[model samples]
Target chain A: DAGITQSPRHKVTETGTPVTLRCHQTENHRYMYWYRQDPGHGLRLIHYSYGVKDTDKGEVSDGYSVSRSKTEDFLLTLESATSSQTSVYFCAISEPGQGPPEQYFGPGTRLTVT
Target chain B: SQKIEQNSEALNIQEGKTATLTCNYTNYSPAYLQWYRQDPGRGPVFLLLIRENEKEKRKERLKVTFDTTLKQSLFHITASQPADSATYLCALDLSRDDKIIFGKGTRLHILP
Candidate 1:
């Protein structure tokens, strides 16, 4: 288990409501990513932050937004929850300066939209 | 467009038998590929990573073969046990301007 933690391990929300997921890391990795896992679609990256105040959209970035104000924290927000957005979300961290380290994942946050 | 394909069906094998999983891709030249193991209700854990120049990599009872020419990768587990049951995922550095992509995944069940 890495020092990464995702808040609200499980949540049930309604459509058209905004929701936020938080990822906190103690390893202080330089790279952090937010991904969603679905039945037919594998793990799809929604957003990633290379460093504080730097972020980029991933393949499935629509309906999702991210913010990273510090090296140890990254947040993902769903502007308006949709039934299609119901999926297990994972947070990952990687240390590029630490000898090609592999990404470590959190336990995961299961989001269900009604 | 870059796309990754994996077996949507689950693979069932008896204990002491071998299991193989497949991952295929198209329209993308990846620099590196990785395999991961995930259990239900949990996130994935890294298993192995193979480079584009490498053909195969192995660890313990697990073996991975990557064929760039075929644009596919095969993962094998020998003499698998019930504990080896889990979903396997393959990811590539599809990287449009440097990005990564993941395949849906193939579930494995080791029956005792």
Candidate 2:
């Protein structure tokens, strides 16, 4: 219930195609992150943004890229999708100085690359 | 590299019994640890957070214990019910770097 939403809740695409997922937030949090969840590998961070135009790679950023042009929107793009990239993607927002830095997550987008 | 390990095996407990899950980490010092609950097809929801300096924290029937020296955290759900069955994840914050790491999560099944 964190004013966060991910577009295209579910999608199925072929391999080697470009795919992009969008995360929009109304909370105006300073930190936003993209993570992928798979069967054996819990949640692995893909990328994160501290502020508009500021982004950094996470542990599993090999096949993904992210960009943030405004505070409320963060985009995760897979230049050339692969079956290995099929997983549930989640977007989270956090307010650093507000409280415990606890993250609020969006509903999630399920992407399947076949 | 830092690693967090949670029991990959599922835990089954009878309804009304207490259920406890464990999270262990190595090679990193985190400032605080957190627990989250996730149902099938849903995003993780925050449960409890315990700081390194705090030995334990309680909310409702959930209790979380943090042992910085041991690099471990324990989550306990008292008087569990079937509705309590879900996957529980443990996360740690790398305070200095403003990043977090999560464990694979332990699934709990409170059978009635």
Candidate 3:
């Protein structure tokens, strides 16, 4: 749990529709990340927020956007949902300089776009 | 391109036996390596981490060995139980990257 919760545990959306997944953390960790996991391909980072209003792109940051308006919330928005974007999305939180920098992840949100 | 590779096929081990898994990487110098366990439909849980300077790290029945020279890591579970059946992912962090890269994972089945 790690005091982390993601809204819409499961979602089914049509192609070209807008979708937003929310990640809320009570631990107030400075670092939060968004990752998508699919078959064959492992977990791939889509976007990460280092601090309030500070974000960076990861290896696979295309067709996706993120926002961290508050310390407890990180939002992932798909402007136009596509079938290729359907997968399990996980939100992880970690504190910098915390020994090994291990991340605590939320349960995950399973999104399917048809 | 940087890459990390783990056992592509599922590994089956008998109960009470030691199960060893391998992780190999190329084209990258990682500051540390980590192992994570993920059950179906659940997020990954961190198992252990080994630094490049450390040869081996142990926690209870779990042990991780890091060989920088070989650019490999070996994860072992002694006295394995059926409950340990899951996918184990090997991830690495580079000194220059803010995010960790992960291998697809090796699914281990502890047959009872």
Candidate 4:
């Protein structure tokens, strides 16, 4: 398994509340990504970071924000939680220039917004 | 917009038989396609990757075939076992954007 870990492995928050999830990696990979998985929708990219302080939005970046101040940590924050946002969040890491760039994912964080 | 489609239904295969899964896409052909496996509660783990130019690639009991003309990819697991039961996902690179899109995944059950 990759040396990646997500904090607050499980979280339950009420609607309109602030929620934040953290992803930490020891691999020092240059690329880090946040993804959300739901039934029937599969996995959707939320945000990604290529290097320190460099980030970009993904296909489903609405209502979500991410910050990568350091190479080892990436954070995802939901300003106000919604029931539709309830899903399993996964953090993945990849090292570019290392061939095909296969991503290694963490255990994932299951978030429930009611 | 690019779309990837995989059978949403679960597939049942007997142990020691071969299991094949299909992934079809619409839009431009990707330079690289990847496969991953996920258990019920865990994140996906990378399995195999095949490039558009390559017709087939193999690793251990797994094989991946890419057909650019058909805009599809096939994943096969031979000599299947009960332990192989899980959801398999297929992902493809979106041109040279450095980002890949994933399919909904197909669940496979290896009945013993």
On DockQ, the leading prediction is 4
Give lDDT tens digits, candidate 2, residues A19-99: 999999999999999999999899989999999999998999999999999999999999999999999999999987877
lDDT per residue for candidate 4 within A4-112, as digits (tens), equals 9999999999999999999999999999999999998999999999999999999999999999999999999999999999999999999968888899999999999
Pairwise lDDT winner, candidates 3 and 4: 4
Task: List TM-score per model, in order.
Answer: 0.95, 0.97, 0.98, 0.98
Question: Which residue runs does candidate 2 get wrong by more than 4 Å?
Answer: none
lDDT of 3 by residue, B1-112 (tens): 8899996558999999999999999998898899999999999999998988999999999999999989999999999999999999999985455589889999999999
Candidate 1 stretches greater than 4 Å from native = B96-98
Q: What is the C-alpha lDDT of each candidate?
A: 0.89, 0.92, 0.93, 0.94
lDDT of 4 by residue, B45-93 (tens): 9999898889999999999999999999999999999999999999998
* Model 2: pairs clashing at backbone N, Cα or C within 3 Å: none
| Model 1 quality (TM-score) | 0.95
The regions of model 3 sitting more than 4 angstroms off are none
The sequence of per-residue lDDT tens digits that candidate 3 reaches over residues A1-114 is 799999989999999999999999999899999999999998998999999999999888999999999999999999999999999999999886866788888999999999
Ranked candidates, highest TM-score first: 4, 3, 2, 1
- Residue-by-residue lDDT tens digits, candidate 1, A2-77: 8999988999999999999999999988899999998877899999999999999888999999999999999999
Q: Which prediction has more favorable DockQ, 1 or 2?
A: 2
Q: Which 10 consecutive residues of model 4 chain B have the lowest summed lDDT?
A: B92-101
Candidate 2, residue B58: Cα displacement in angstroms equals: 0.4
> Model 4's lDDT to the true fold?
0.94
Could you tell me how far off, in angstroms, the CA of residue A62 lies in candidate 3 after the best superposition?
0.6
DockQ, 0 to 1 scale, candidate 1 = 0.69
